[model samples]
Target: MKKLICSLLIALPLTTHASSTLRCDSGLISLQDSTSIVSSKCGEPISREFVGYREVQDEYGFYNEVAVEEWAYGPRNGMFQFLRFEGNRLIKIDSKRGR
Candidate 1:
């Protein structure tokens, strides 16, 4: 039981960091920023995707519907990033590794 508890405590931080919100450009990109802001600041992405309606749970624990979108950016031969947007709000950013 003690070993299990210790292992869980050690793993907790990894899970927390895994789901942590992502930021870009020293805080230029944040969770609450709108898609328009991202476009103007980050310029046009290399690829864009419309994910359509998705059922989501809000901070208040209420289920709601939201429109999801994804944008990908890459600079020539550099790393590529994937940004997810929900209802015009930037929600998540994922970087492609081993690029």
Candidate 2:
């Protein structure tokens, strides 16, 4: 029992960090998916906000400004999923319980 509890505790953070994927009605959306792909699978988010711009460096050692945005889709099971995008790719997925 103790070993099981310890294993579960160690695995908790890994699950939390693996929130980079979301299941939609059509398909699954994951990190690095394009904005168009996410929108198509998720069928449009409830809200989209322009977060700002991030400077990203490429393999060529050139830095460019990429648009950053957050798209929210929710109240599904009383939880909201927020997707963060940089440049045109989905970078992160977060979920929170709604009030």
Candidate 3:
């Protein structure tokens, strides 16, 4: 019983990521690609954007009732220096943390 519980605990996190991949129309890509590609496929962003970093390296998107987006950049570039879009609205994205 103790062994089963321990095994499950370890297996749980592993299963979610089972692979170092994020699905995309082109197939699996790095985590960065997962976020960026959405924009191209989905069309112009609705507004949310990231901020902080001095340079914006990548862009992302997601839309439901509201459009949401995130722009990221190389680490050390800044806290975010990226962008976020919330349905035709823009916000400085905090790449360090994303939704």
lDDT of candidate 1 over 1-99, digit per residue (tens)? 345434333433322122234444434676768999888778777667777898988899999999999876653344455678998998887654322
Which pairs clash inside model 1?
Answer: none
TM-score per candidate, chains pooled: 0.62, 0.79, 0.24
CA error at residue 66 for candidate 2, angstroms: 0.5
Residues 1-99, model 3: lDDT tens digits: 345434334433322212233233344333334344544543333233432233333346533454455543322322222334444334333333211
Candidates 2 and 3 compared: the better one by lDDT is 2
Number of the predicted model whose lDDT against the real structure is largest: 2
Better of 1 and 3 by lDDT: 1
Error of 3 at 41 (Å): 22
- In terms of TM-score, which candidate is strongest? 2
lDDT of 2 by residue, 3-96 (tens): 5434434433332323878999899999999999999999978777787999999999999999999887766886667789999999899876
lDDT of every model, 2 decimals: 0.65, 0.79, 0.37
Is 2 or 3 the stronger prediction by TM-score? Answer: 2
TM-score of 3: 0.24
